[model samples]
Target: MKFHMLHRVYLLAGVSYFATAPDVLADPVSLLATAIQGFLLSSTAIAATATGAIATIAANAIVIGGLAAVSLLGGRRGGAIKPSDAKSTFEAADSSVIEGIGRVRVGGMKAFGNTDGSTRWRLVARLQGPIDAIEAYYVGGREVVVDPDGSVTSPPWPKRSGGSWMKIEDKLGTGSETAWSALVTAFPSLWTSAHRVRGIAQSLVTYYNPGLTSGTYLKLYQAGVPDTEWLARASKIYDPRTGLTAWSDNGILACAHVLRRDPAFGFDGFDWDLIAASANKADVLVATKTGTEKRSRVSGMWAWESERGATMQQLMDSAGVVLRMTDAGKIWFDLIDDVPTSEIDFDPIDIVEYSWKSGPEAVERPNICRLEYYSPERNYDMAEIDLSGIAWARVQDEIDRYGPKYLDIKLPFCPSASQAQRIARRMFALSRADSGVMRTNMVGLAAWGRYYGQITEPDTGDIELVSLAAPEIDDEAGLVDIPFAIWPTLSAWNPAVDEADAPDEVPELGYTSDIPQPNAPTAMVQVVYPDTSREFRIGFSLTGTYDLSEANYRTYTGALPNGWTAMTEGTNFAYVAGDLEGVTVDCRVRIFNGEDGSPFSEILNGIVAIDNTAPTMPVASSGGIDAGTLNVSVHGTSLNMVAIRMRKRIYNDILGWGDWFDVVTYAGRPMQDLNFSDSAASQEVQWLLQCLTSNGTEGPGLVYHYTPPAP
Candidate 1:
């Protein structure tokens, strides 16, 4: 049997060994070579002899073959057995071709080869139990176990009689029951291995789920036992079928776990207790249960779900928290609106590059005429709020002008709509507020300086009032800007006062200083006639060199035909006369410097005229008539230059008089009598005349009739 195994090994190595006699040599080197050849020949002879000597081991031919093959490969590769080659040979050999089933001899085989008998048994034993155990276990039918050698086996059924049957009949039911008990004894170790395999499978399946991070696959692999309860929980947490909550919760838990585990994310200083307290105040749960906080109570749950590729930072951003690294290299998680205690300034020197855009595109102003907020705690589902009446009227006016814009924001921990609305409105106002960017290159102007307060440009005298948002800066780039709120300084003007004094004058003590002789007062005189009365008055506006109080004024030469007298010695003076119509008067002002004894001042002359009446209408008298023409005499007013207009029409005709024509020579002239010729036609001709005075007054009309002479 050993010989057969050695032959099989030789066949596996693809080589054959045939014993042959070596020729004897006299020389030493040739003798040495001949001896070595003789030794190999002897080894082959022994292998053949041993194969014929052990027929009982023939049934274990395959195992023998595997060992022989290991021996041959070891001999070729410097006398060391390759475990991989042995395993492959054992796995590939046909068990059916071998005659019997029993462990093959592996010890004391110096003639055949040096084989590791212990290692060979261990590999066989390691594979043997699972095969035996699986065969022993049973379900509806007896379970079958397939061996690595391609042999299948099943455990025997319980006997109906004898001791085994009696034992089975008394307590255990059948052989399958006994086998199952044995299998259960070894199930833990087996289940652990199976669980690890399942974890790998699950990770592969969920690799494409959104919000997956670098450590997600590791987490999935570490997930404990697979059971219905665990699966249900996993489905609730990660199943997209459950809607945004599941995916979001998964992402949140994933990020939370990552944050908790990261050494740089200073969870040591995080106030979990405070977060718990604040979360509990909501009366609804907000904080999610985490692996690190298993024992702590969670009052709420929050999910952050987005597209499949969303990053951990993006999820945290959606939660309205900022994740930043501190100067000490620790991570800080803060509310989006939290203001830093220190101020930050980013000057032009600190910025590398920057751009700004403002208009309808940067900020959308919506009308928002009405505001309503969801209120689950209130009696009503929603509560109405006033937007226009708020203090942010300027913001509202922008909204009103632009049109209504709607935004629904979720405030996770807010207890009531009132609170939520206040926060929402504040956030909205901040969002719509003015923002700008100023790039600078100053390194000391860190991001902290942006919130520090105002930054002033000393050179330009331009000041940025308040920082609206955080500054983005880092050591490498050394560039940043006070992003959001910026108000430029207003320009102003200053005035200077002149420094000077006035001189003083004194008057004589007892007697008033001799009144200085008054200069002639310039006078403007206008004659006005009152419609209510026939009286006329001269209106005068006067400017004098001396104070009017020190001067006495009087109307001088050429006052009206009547004895018109001046009423007062003031800058404005008037003289009244009842019968001054059609008269012109030369008026002058005489100013007395002081009392009656003072000499009169030089006269200031002005002219005033009154002509309140219009001229009388002209009278026309007919003269001798000639063929087709007639001569007539016309008389007009004698007070002033007079003009005449004449129109002709047939006597007793219903048609109105023709257009008037001016007596050109008599127009605006001082003539009272004028002769004119009019056309004499087949019927009688009538003449109508009206007169206008030089003062532009018009009088009533007069008519004259004449008959043309026969041709």
Candidate 2:
């Protein structure tokens, strides 16, 4: 709750580009196919212009926006083009049935078939609802798509659901083809096919049922598929359980064919090669060759030694990578070195745990992990650690040690809480465990600058707003590099330029410094954008130090010359500016006890000095001792002018401050020039000879004079 003062001055005119945002958008040229067509006309132009990127990939991904007009309009058209066929029904004739509740059967069903005697039949049925409020419901079916090539062809048979569901079917010619078919239908909406549907069903079971693994689900698919059809030969499933999406290709034509269709899942499908060239694109396909050659390679061992007191290896060994651990032991891929190979693939995702350690010297180290391939994508993740399920003791300890360090910068304009959270969080690689951990409801941090303005912390009150001033032509006369000192609250910040004819009372973004305040605890801080009338938010948690409303008494004032004009003033603050040489300002501030209205006793009172006096002319210092020396130095009459003061800033790492020290106030000895043996031979002595003849009135100001120090 402590308040601190920060006075930053920015030179108005300088660089061609003003503010440099922390995030660098992804290669714009890389946005092709679905991404381009999806985000093109929406916020694409604005994002492109503002970020100066050609393609819309980075802009579309990071920028908060409404649905693209083209998409919305197309959706409307699609609604109009609503399939000529609406509802669909599936009928199969099977003999064995459990009539009372949900039934199970094995033979003679059109969609169901018995390939092997020991194989079991599974039935799955679903109900597809309306276009808008429609929801898909699984009805139930045992066998489907047997003799799929002969029996099922073209548009394929309608799934046991409403017509709203699109029907797609792919026949597997071999075991590999079955796998490939399953992969194609993994995500129903994204891809549709009988094999894919079967694969998705198995994936669903594996994810939801603890005892059921992907193999168990696959067994059900194998048992249900009719013997009349050919099995697939190649197919790789993209695991959705993990954050990363990696694909595998068996060197078989199926996998390669799918990839060759669109290398990066439609990324290269677009005609734009510039984007493909600019983007980070990679494809890895491993296969067994006819003959094996002996080779020696260096195995890489990346050891993350935790200065925070624990090693990643120990944590992983204990926790394991699976979401849930059971008595059967943790489920994770064991590192195997069966083949005489040199290099083992290492990924950051493979890391299991990290421990926090701190020292008396204020140093903190946490043993975390980095992916060998994508080192930039490090995660604080202890592979199997579900931070949500962590013990309270550990969580609290983390909260105490690190304060808000884990939280990313939350901008106000982001679309949703999730987007805001993601933006706020540093990428897993950039995450530092020692930094304070903050709880967030979602992933990306929202950048809603229009709502929130700059944040301020005054000396005697809770953190408040010091509305940033509308950029004006300073005497220096230059376009203000705004971010040099003041940062906007949001990324899509569109500030309105004030007009010369506009009334001062009107709150124009660029010209008026009108900062808004929060109305309620839940109400976000909203500010009218300078450029456009649209309002934006400035983000910050209001519950922290300002939990209560308490007034403080402070007798503080800045020492400024009288000639300067006071642009604005507040109950506890005021701003005045003028040409430094033309003003003679004196300002002082003192803190006092509010209850008694008396000066509060402290180590030292707050005082800022200002000198508007011009450099005075030097005088002839004839100490009458005529033999001692004629020290020609400026001897000022006023105490303030006696010591010419200037402010010097030094960076203080320990204190997290740029220490602004008063350079002139030091009680050190002054530099003296004497018309003696040494001074007589120097330029200083030559000045003195001229000064003695001119008598004080026509020469430089002698600020001060003193005797030589004891050598």
Candidate 3:
């Protein structure tokens, strides 16, 4: 007789269910509903039948000494089972328990017996209504009832080394080593039953504190066992050579041990087979991807240790995968870059309401420009991978404008900088992609069904989905589809356009007195004679004004001094000759504004004193100091109209020449003799004089040196 080979190459090893025959026998029926109902109702009968068939197959294999190859049939195929059917089956089973209880309305109860053949037995039960207390009793021994607030009325258990049973005020407080030891010691039946003791403690703690984590439960459970023994027991369950168990209860203890022992074990390779094997050995289901896409091998080690400890979910995140559990308690893995395989469309007709939001807060840019990892064994640092080339400009621009937004991840497991950089790049890319999140809302379930799946808006050609709500639900329908909240894909978010053609506003026109002439409060105005058709070149200071090319011309208008005239040529204004000494003239200028000339500036009044000639130098008469007094005479052609200034120096035979004395002056009064009282004891003295015209013009100086009487 032909028989199906039970062993599947893809199935993980050490699965005992398929040791004899095929794990799942082919059901010879097409109607799924009937098959499901029959299977559920007569599961025991089916198991017995399969056992007998397996025995027959085993006998035949012994005789033949070789197993024959048979076509493999995929396990049960159909749409997901309806939740109502499963719920009804569960309710029916619960009803059977209720019926067995008969008239005694036991609120809740649990019993435990020693598997190690001890005569001791333990039972914990909650009394109905008025009693309002949970009681724990040993067979043929004393019973203790505890109030909801952990107030115990004389516990039957004795105190342990670290803690006391009588002192436990709450379920959460029972996680201490002494408390756990007290519970096990008080009830000897739990001495050899680790799983039972853990379950009972977890139930109690969860009853008191619903927020207690599975990790916390494992920690509390392991507190009673020695580290060596715990490791040995955990290895037996999570080594893969042994059978994998459910991830809860004792299995959680095994997982915690392995994680706490070697946190970087998962990052050893890029192969999913190894990762899945490790997860399976730990009684965790880390789903594998079935595709031809190239996989990345991580060479570095990733290590983490915290007093609060870490969850398996955080481990999955470190490995760059999202952890999701199915309804059957199986695990699923989704890559960070995995896009939705299907799209859902929600048109305006199907949507009852909608909302959307986008702003600067949602914008994300690359933060990490490089990645570095250290290797202690190598005694030297690994080569640095240059991430500056990847989106360098964008990352730099963000840093330049908003300071450095760097994310430096410490990955000790990374054997090389290249691999660490790859991980960093992946994180950077994901962050950048998530930065511009466009959250939107719509009504109704007429869209794709899956968390993180894509949804297309027919009205605006936008694709969105509720990405924040994962594992629990992926689509708007799961959230009742009323005002479905979703986020737009990074590629679908349109950035604002940059308007480059718009010009900046022009500044107002103004001027200042740039070049001030002597005795002139305004800018210098060059006077020219028109005898040879000469023009004066007057330069003016201007600001808040455009370049010459940008402006048409400068216009000049002023009150001329008889022979002077002003005219606008180009940027410069031409002025005819003007012998206008002591004549004040008012002048103003306006610049062309493309369409029309600007308003004339405020009037600038300046006296026209076109005297460019310097005053004649003063002459100093030669003289020698005779009685601590030196006298000198200075003369000039324009001495009456100019002030005389003089400086004197004294020279001694030993001290050389003394510094020039302070300048002395005579106001426009031409002095025949200039006198200075010499206080210095020097052998020689020198005097220098200069003349300044009334217009403040200074002439060259005349120098005279003479010997002074020795003191």
Candidate 4:
């Protein structure tokens, strides 16, 4: 149902009754639908979107074995991360590096360690550099503010037995670090001038305790306690455009560093000039909540160790970037942006044959993306975030009609909340708009420079946008079978300005231990039936003792929202009455006490009360000869409009094209008649006829061959 509706993989390792839960006594189908929203369920779900998903079997189900979170499509070292792979922080065991751009918190290797056996102890940490700068320090898993001179400010240091304090000496080394002269002076043989440690961010920590007993001194000195951890900005990378290195968190700059730095992980000894030029023009593109900011910039971070490809993917996912690999093995990347990057403007003649395919059903699609990630703001520990202000997404009436749906995902290497939110927003945008696949078969040179995945449908009169594809070729048949995902172009959405702050995750929405149902916010929904479409309007209408002003309603569509929006600072939520166009279906109001749902007032015009079935494929006429022209007839239950298009072919060569035209049907006709004229000079044509309801839903199309009689 849509008045106009509005709309990630999240990693929810132990997703405890996540998202919306329907009442236990509810119908089994409703219960299953609610369960499908929060978890990355198996393929078989409650219902399919295109068809009525009574029990749908999905094609894409997420795998979150461990990692309270890790990004989508999994990482490179063969497959996804498993439970056995979960461990303590990588800072303790791995040597960290910052590639591309962005700021990150890193732990370092102890290059030097010395203890005087009584009063003093010294240790040196070495970091990969020359880096941009050390921004902050995370000592004991907490970010601590520091002065320019390396003195801790916020958490005042605690003293030892002899009034001695810990202190740090930092060398913000851009390959110009000097030796520890004082350590050399105190113990010449142990610490020397050769320990300059140039080209690395170096830190020397000292602990001195003058008056301690033997046992106390040994315990304090031998303990594995560490000093301040370093959070530094990554150094500039080579921009093929500038012929120099510069500071940037740009996707191309990041991906380039991954590909050219070291022989072990880099794709060195190859020509990247073409890739670099593509980057110069395309790297700046980024995902936008507005769907208008084509040159929107994105950012990412890397502080953990992983396979080389995984690192590259994190950068791409963080920036909502699209990396296209060609059959020729050439690598190209672009942002999940609104801008059209394709070279050729398409014409219908390019499509020799085409068929429409439905994307994941609403049951399979998750509206809320519970994205888990590590945050630099939280001292490099795990954090979760989502997006709510994104426009033109699946924030439609479904969330209010069904229940909350969730797609739990993780960005293992992503550290910024804003970056994580961008990726989550992209998931929602693409899932809502790019769900259908157009299986287009063509035999032409029109797609010479265009990627197989970047093509759009040729017919302009359809209700779709630029189509997405996963490429396959029928080499023997001499056809490129490009199954295209119907992707709505951003510019077409004309997305409204969304300035609301994307709601941040607030300590698991206050649910801890055994979940107690919230004793408030029983909601009501008005199911409006217009001529063709169903519009559902919902809001919490202050019942019981729960104050309407203080209550925050987190409505679930089928999944969790990309981000959660609560009653922050008295935010005004828009409301609609339970009746539209003065028609009401007698039913029970929806109950959302916890994150669970109740039954809807089920009513269908001219159908059973509990029906949610879709009209099947329509039967169309084979273009029989009548009145000196070809006659076409389309049949369906709730018959709508007939979309007809034709093209001519002769001698095994396809010729000119005909744009799609819709024949709107009127009620009370036993059968509808479609008339075609000769304004465009119809010849022997391949006629494509499809059905579109007034609400703009489509069914499988029918094809026929027709020839016009001479006038």
Give the winner by lDDT: 4
Best by TM-score: 4
Candidate 4 local distance difference test against the native: 0.41
Residue range 1-711, candidate 4, lDDT tens digits: 101000011112222222433222132321221111222211112133533221111111122222323334232231112211211222233233323245555554455566666435444443345556555454544334344444443222323322224556676546555567767777888656765555545566666553466554544444445445655665666666677776555655565564443222234322367657556555443344533332323333433233334445555665555555332323455555544454444446556666665555666656665666555444454565434544433455667766667766666545545456555555656666544333334443334224323444556545344544433445555555444455544443322342223334332111232322333323323232224333322223323322223222222223211111122111112222222323322211222233222222121211112112222455654445443354655554332232222322322225455555543332211134444332223555554444443343455555555556555
For candidate 2, give the lDDT: 0.20
Q: How many residue pairs clash in each candidate?
A: 31, 90, 13, 38
Better structure of 1 and 4 per TM-score: 4
TM-score, candidate 2, is 0.18
User: Which wins on TM-score, candidate 2 or candidate 3?
Assistant: 3
lDDT string for model 1 (178-214, tens) is: 2112212334442222121110001000011112353
Runs in model 1 lying further than 4 Å from the true structure: 1-321, 335-342, 346-363, 366-394, 412-415, 448-453, 457-711
Can you give the lDDT of residue 390 in candidate 4? 46
Ranking by TM-score: 4, 3, 1, 2
Candidate 1 TM-score, C-alpha based: 0.25
lDDT of 3: 0.32
Give the CA lDDT, 0 to 100, for residue 146 in model 3: 32
TM-score of each: 0.25, 0.18, 0.26, 0.48
